[model samples]
Target: MAVWSLWSLLLWEALLPPEVTHAQVQGQVGGHALLVANRPSSFQVREAIWRSLWPAEELLATFFRGSLETLYHSRFLGRAQLHSNLSLELRPLEPGDSGNFSVLLVDTAGRAWTQTLQLKVYDAVPRPVVQVFIAVSGDAQAPKTCQVFLSCWAPNISDITYSWRREGTVDLGIEPSGLFTDGPALRVSLGPEDKSVAYSCIVSNPVSWDLATVTPWESCHREAGPGRASYKDVLLVVLPVLLLLILAGVSAWHLGPCSGKKKKDVCADEVAPEAENPLV
Candidate 1:
């Protein structure tokens, strides 16, 4: 589960924090790091011993240049190596491996030196999420003048930071407060000229960062809720129902005249039988 790779300059720029000395090295869990003591080669015929100093003090390795043989400690067995260049390499770093370490070096002339290094291991940062909720000045009535709240977060991580920023230029309307941020949340006040603008939320730690982008104008400027229909949609539905009602009224009026004609004809056909009897 361990393999060594070349440490590129760009990788160090991204991982190393500010004000850290060359002796300080940061790595991700399940990754590799090479710790160098930066000892000058002029100090010849040397012996070196490396030890873990913080959290727990323990011996890592001991090397003698004359014998060209090294002894390893159980803590770093099968996972650490002492190189000829007087550097220590650790692969597949563990979470419990963070702390301070030092190396004691003795030259042929009996002069001794000690170098200390700080090691830190971190978990990779996960992708962040952005969510938004909008509130109008008069409930659902004053949509043009409303507040938009956006929240950004990453899950289950520690020692992280949140930052909010807008991508491009924006023109604010009504309230004209524009945008303001507090920690992971941002508040925006929409006005008349409030066009669509992109916003980014960044979540980061010392070693990694992730960002999410959203445009609040898309949701805030929408005139209709998901459950409500637009004006054009309502007209499209009502026009068909009105046409059916007008057709029904015309058919009922035509049937009324036919019924009256039929009644008059029946009376004429009945004749005056009583009058005929009197004439006889």
Candidate 2:
């Protein structure tokens, strides 16, 4: 019985494909994943086979000489392709399609080479929404700069990270502990210099990223402080008045009483008209 068992083990080992280190590949839903075989082009190949082993071991495709064959009734039938170079292509990938895939390349001399890969699929992340609000610092009566809280959120995502930046500048590098809430938010004190800058929030996961931006003038609503006026607000109120004043000055210079003809000619014409009436 022991001799028979040993023989069976040897047979099983002989049938198994050669072992190689596995590699990881990442893909998104509605995309494609390619598994490349590293076989040397100079090596003559008689046949090749591709299989999947996770969830269950199943034959995926086979290549004989110059011809290719895919499993007719398999779930991957219409979406899998075997290339002449012993590479496999899976298209229109779904989340459930991620798992282990293996390729076995058989040389014309009856020797086989094999490799395995692990695939991971993720859903694309959507754009994040950012909200900003003012939070008073210390006591309300204490003359302190107001703190602004920025909240960033995305739906139906996990394992996400948040980053902040002042637009057109370097990253804000806000620490996680500086957030007002415990999650994806940031707390910052608004300095006089910050009023003219725009802040952006970036949210990301392993697969994708998104951004949202807010300007300090538009996002934070407050009564103008004693001597503080937003540059944007000042421009909005001052620019139109300045334009109107310029227009009025140009009109007066072009159309006023002294604009056309000489004053001496008018006086001479009035005196000549009186002399022509000459009853005195």
Highest TM-score against the true fold, candidate: 2
Clashing pairs in 1: 173-191, 173-192, 174-191, 174-192
lDDT tens digits by residue: candidate 2, 1-280? 4335334433543787564656888887798888887776676877677788886787777776577777545668799988777788889888798789887776766666777899887777778888878764445543535577888888887667777766655336653442223356777677655677777788776677788888754444463455567666799999999999999999988775544468556766767978888696
Model 1 TM-score is: 0.63
Tens-digit lDDT track of model 1 for 1-280: 0011112212332454312233888888788777886665676635666678888887676666443223445566777787787688888898888888877666666555567899998877888899988764565655456578988989988788888877665455332344435488888776556656778888887878888989877676564445667567799999999999999999878766435677657655565565467654
Per-structure clash totals for the candidates: 4, 0
What lDDT does model 2 reach? Answer: 0.72
My TM-score estimates for the predictions, one after another, are 0.63, 0.65
TM-score of 2: 0.65
lDDT of each: 0.70, 0.72
